[model samples]
Target chain A: DTAVSQTPKYLVTQMGNDKSIKCEQNLGHDTMYWYKQDSKKFLKIMFSYNNKELIINETVPNRFSPKSPDKAHLNLHINSLELGDSAVYFCASSQDTDGGTEAFFGQGTRLTVV
Target chain B: SQELEQSPQSLIVQEGKNLTINCTSSKTLYGLYWYKQKYGEGLIFLMMLQKGGEEKSHEKITAKLDEKKQQSSLHITASQPSHAGIYLCGADSSNAGKSTFGDGTTLTVKP
Candidate 1:
């Protein structure tokens, strides 16, 4: 079984459209995170949730919202997608609550806005 | 914001050669992590070093954290083509444990 799994491995959407990526982990982790990797391959944390509570939220735009339905799921929903939002989105999970925890990542979902 | 600098941007070497990649932080790090990503893929956890002077190894890959807790190095010995990928170093920042990754190190190994 996949430890962390994400739906829509590839997404192509028009600008101004709304899209959502679903993530689920069977590892029974307490923390989930959403990261975006740009064309330069720089990975940045967009949002993090611990035990269904919002934790670390970087300087991401308000258009990007992360929702944790439970301890095993974290989903990313973007309103009015932009070309700038075209990148690889990753969903990861960690068993720990704080720093210094090893994370398991999903294969990744490539988002392309036309 | 905590900035992380990594180098060299890209590397190519013959198989069986040794290579090293570095990640440094502008601010002190609470913990450091090493991840690998194949082309167009998500980051894969390799290892994590928390305390200063901490060292961890898996197979032919080994990572070391500087005593100052400001820098880290990922070294690969007897490298193979399978080791070719982008290696990223991330840190748990002071403000939060948020992970900020460097640009990346794209590695290519030839037979």
Candidate 2:
């Protein structure tokens, strides 16, 4: 069984379009996060939710929003997709408690904006 | 800002050789985690170090946390092509559940 899964694995959209990537974790983890990996391989956190509560919101743009309907699902929605937003997006989950924060990442969604 | 810097951005080694990668944190770390990511895939958790002077090994990979807890190292023994991937080090600076990841070290093992 997949511990953490995100879809669609690849995304190609045009500028000014809106898109959403869905993520789910079956590990029963309490914390879920969205990360963006640029071409330089820099993985930066964009948002984090714990038990459906927003915990950490990094310096991501307002056009990007993350929603967690429950503890097992966290989805990322991007509006007015720009070419600069072309990068791989990853979803991750963890236990949230101190010393239990080992994250399990999803197989990333490669977003291409044209 | 909290940052984790990994040295030797990329390395290539023979199948039987050994190599080491280092991660330095700009701020004190509450915990350090090591992960490996294959090309076009998600990251796989390797190990987590919480205390200073802690060392753990799994298979041919060993990770150590420095005495000051600001530095960490990952060493691989008898490298194999199967070990070729990107190794990343993540640090939790505040113990608040947010981890900052390094840029990652790309390793290529030749058969």
User: lDDT winner among the candidates?
Assistant: 2
Give the Å error, residue A102, model 2.
Answer: 0.8
The collision pairs in model 2 are none
For residue B56, model 1's alpha carbon misses the true position, in angstroms, by: 1.7
TM-score of each: 0.95, 0.97
Tens-digit per-residue lDDT, B35-67, candidate 1: 999986667889999999999999999999999
Residue pairs in candidate 1 whose N, alpha carbon or C atoms collide under 3 angstroms: none
DockQ of 2: 0.70
Error of 2 at B84 (Å): 0.4
Residue B90's lDDT in candidate 1: 84
What residue runs in model 1 are displaced by over 4 Å at the alpha carbon? Answer: none
Best by TM-score: 2
Off by over 4 Å in 2: A97-100
Q: After superposition, how far is residue A89 of candidate 1 from its true place, in Å?
A: 0.7
Correct interface contacts retained, every candidate: 0.75, 0.68
Q: Per-residue lDDT for B1-111 in model 2, tens only?
A: 539999889999999999999999978899999999998899999999999999999999999999999999999999999999999999888757778899999999999
